[model samples]
Target: MAGLTKDTPYPTEIKLHQKSRILDITFSDGKTFQFPCEFLRVYSPSAEVSGHGPGQEVLQTGKKMVSIVKIEPVGNYAIQLNFTDGHNTGLYSWDLLYNFGLNQDKMWQRYLQRMDEAGASREPASRASTAQHSCK
Candidate 1:
């Protein structure tokens, strides 16, 4: 919502691969990006995840298996991604998407660093092995 401009490259194609848990998107400028569901969920631009301002970002954990259940277009500027985890507030604009595609690697590294610093794991807690237990 902050970066969309008149020159922003709009999406030409968008495909969701359920089995692979990837969103493959192609922009009007011939750039294609494959966005993993977990990455998207962790990096969601919604206020709930990104917070209302700087230094208020909430670190998302246990979302490695999250998936996009639906995609809805918002007029001509953006699209809303409905995640399987019930998150659906972020309006991913063309500019934001393009920037994400271009900076994914750097952003991903930053995310990993943050996660490590916070001692967080991306694996969902519900999926943790039942083999480990404490004696009563």
Candidate 2:
């Protein structure tokens, strides 16, 4: 997959709410998105989170109370998130962020389906499995 570059127009602001576990981002082009902590947790772009193959993806569940503790810049292409629940590996690229911003609904639905298949609940705050994987 292609990552973003310095010229890539990223969001102007990215606010993390510790109490509500929400990541509110406002793009420079006037688009605003409020991605929930659970949403961001489930959609983490880290190789540990997203699998290498399409069907190899592991479902993330029980992250409703997870909060974003930090947003560190990774070069000019992505931002590394430090989740309150101790997940700090994901490197969210601008392109991936934009795509997630656009396909939130569909992706969320798919996540729910995957959770159901895994007999998981979305209400708790459990640590996602650390079976190393990639999303390429």
**lDDT of each model, Cα atoms only?**
0.86, 0.77
The regions of model 2 sitting more than 4 angstroms off are 5-8, 125-136
| Tens-place lDDT digits, model 1, residues 1-136 | 4576777889999999999999999998899999998888888989999999988899998787799999999999889999998999998888888888999989888888887788777777775453232211
Candidate 2 matches the true fold with a TM-score of: 0.82
Worst lDDT window (10 residues) for model 2?
Answer: 127-136
Best candidate per TM-score, number? 1
What RMSD, rounded to one decimal, does every model reach?
Answer: 5.1, 6.7
The pairs that clash in candidate 2 are 51-134, 52-134
C-alpha TM-score for every candidate: 0.90, 0.82
